[model samples]
Target: MKTDKTIRTHIVFSIAIVASALLEPCANASSIVGTKHDLSSYTNSSGQICIACHTPHNAQADQLVPLWNHAATTTQFTLYSSVTAKSVPGQPTGYSKACLSCHDGTLALDSFGGKTPAGAGKISGANNLGTDLSDDHPVSFTYDTNLATAHPGIVSPASAAFVDTAKTVPLFNGKLECSSCHDAHDNQNTFFLRKSNAGSALCLSCHNK
Candidate 1:
C-alpha cells in the first residue's frame, strides 16, 4: 500500500498535469486561444475560446448574429460624419455591429451565449471604443466605385467586387465594415489589424494617399 506522503505527492502531480493541459492551448499565438480575444480564462463552464464569440449551433437569433454568441447592445452610436466626405455613413451594421457588441463598452465581454452580464466585466481602457465614434475611421458605409470616384481620398477596389486584387480587405456587399480592417480570430498583427499598418501600409491599402 502507498504511504500517506506518497499518495499526497501523486495527487499534486496529477493536478499539475491537468492544469497544464488547460493552459497550453492559450499559450499558442497561432489561434484565438492566446490572443486578447481569448475569453476562456474568465469562463466557468466551457474551455472553448470561440464560445465567447461564436457557436456551432443554437446561437442568439435576433442581433449581432449569423450564429453570434453574444447579446447585442442597444446603443445608437455617433458615427463618423464630415461635410466633405462623399461616403454616406450609417449606423453600425453587419460585422461592424457585431464587433460593437463588446467594443462599444456598453456590454460586458463575457455576456455571450444568452448570458447577460456574466460577471466577467466590460472591456476597458484602449480596447473600449465607447459610443462616440466621430473621431474614428468611418464604418458601415458603401465603398463602391461611385463613392470612390466622388472622393479623391478613397481608392476604388481594383476588382470592383472586392477591396483589393488580393481580396484580403473584404467589403460586405460593397459596404465597408469593421471586419474590413480587423480580423477577430487572428491577431498576428498589432490590435488585430488585418494587415500591418507599419508606415501606414494598411491605411494606404484603401486610402488614395
Candidate 2:
C-alpha cells in the first residue's frame, strides 16, 4: 500500500533529520547558549541568550562596548598597587569595568534590558571579584614595549592590540584587561579562558617567567 507521494515525503524527512544532525556539532562548538553568562532564564527576558549583554537596537551610547545592554557599574574600585611594580594602574576602565558590573557584587546577574532584577542574585563565591582588586591580577593597565623594558619578567607585546604573535591574547585599546585572558563568548576552555591554563601556559604567553 506504498504510494509514490508517501515515499517521497519519507525521503525528504530523512534528509532534513540527517542535515540537522550534521549541523549540531557546529552549533555546540562555539556559542554562549548553555554557558554561565546566558541569563535568558529571567522571566521578563525575550528568552534569547545574547539579550543578556547585547541588543540589536538602541544600545547605551555611553558604553564603549559595542551594543551594550547591561547597566554600567559606578563603583570607584580600589585598584592594585605595588612599590616595585612599574605599571601604575588607575581606575578600572572599558571591558574590565563591563565584567565588574556583575562581578563587583553591586549589580544582579539579571540587571540588563533596562529593567530591575526580580531577585538579588549576584556573582558570589570565587566568581565575585568585589570592589577591592588588590589581590587579583592587575588589569586595565598599559602593557607595551616601554612597560616591558622597564618591568622585569614581562615580555614585550607584539602590538597594541594583541600580546602574542599568534594574537590569541587581546588588549582593549592598548591596555591589558579582564577580557585579555578571558573570552566572554566561548567556554570551550574552563573559566572562559582564551586558552588552557595547564602548567600556566596562558600566563607564560604574557609573562616571561
Candidate 3:
C-alpha cells in the first residue's frame, strides 16, 4: 500500500505530464510554409518551401527583402487616400513590395530562384490584389504620433499601450505596411492576422474606434 506522500507525488507527476503535453506546439496546417504558398507545381524544383521566397546565397543585394529569391514588382500602384486620412503613403516598399511581387498577379508564383518559367505561374482568385491599390488599405505609410494626432481614431504606434501590450500591431521602420496587420508565417488567426480580430480586438489595438 502507498503512503499519503507517495500518492501526492504520483498525482503531481501525472499533472506535470499532462501540462507538458498541453504546452507542446501543434501543427499549423494553415501556415504559409506548407499551404498553397508552397510552389511544388513548378518544374526543376527541390520541393522546398522557403526556396519560393528565399535562397541561402547569391540573393539580390540591393533590395531590402531578406535573401529574396523572387523578382520584385515594378508595377506602379494607385495608392489609397481619403479626406480624413492624415498619413501620406508612398510607393510600396519593404515587405509590402515583397508580398505584391506575387499577390499583384502580374508575376508568376513559380518565377523564383533566378529562374523564370515559360508561361510562369500567376496568382488568381481573391488572393490577387493587383497593382491598383486604391480600394485596399493604404500601406507603406508612416504611422507616427503625428498621424495619430491628426487622426484621433488611430493610436500612436509609439504608445506604451500598443508597444508594451501582448497583442501588438507591428510596424516596419515606424511605418504601417502589409505585414503590420498580417503574419505571413503564422495563420493561427484567420487571414494570417497577427492576433485574433474577433470583436475587432486587432483593429481596436490601432484604431480607438
* Candidate 3: Cα lDDT at 133: 95
Candidate order by decreasing lDDT: 2, 1, 3
Residue 71, candidate 3: C-alpha displacement in angstroms: 0.5
lDDT of 3 by residue, 1-209 (tens): 99999999999999998986554324454556544555655534566677778888988664657898887888999999999898899999998999998899988877777776665568888999988999999999998889898898888777887886425478878888898888777766757788889998888888887
Residues 1-209 of candidate 1 have per-residue lDDT tens digits of 99999999999999999998677555745577767788897666667787888888888886455678888878898888889898888999878989988898888888877787654588788888999989899999988878878888777775453434335588886788989888887776757778878898778777767
**Candidate 2: residue 99 lDDT (0-100):** 91
TM-score of predicted model 1?
0.80
Clash tally for model 2 = 0
Off by over 4 Å in 3: 1-26, 29-33, 43-45, 165-167
Residue 176 in candidate 1 has what lDDT? 85
Total clashing residue pairs per candidate? 0, 0, 0
Off by over 4 Å in 1: 1-29, 63-65, 118-120, 158-166
For model 2, the superposed segments whose C-alpha errors exceed 4 Å read: 1-28, 43-46, 159-166
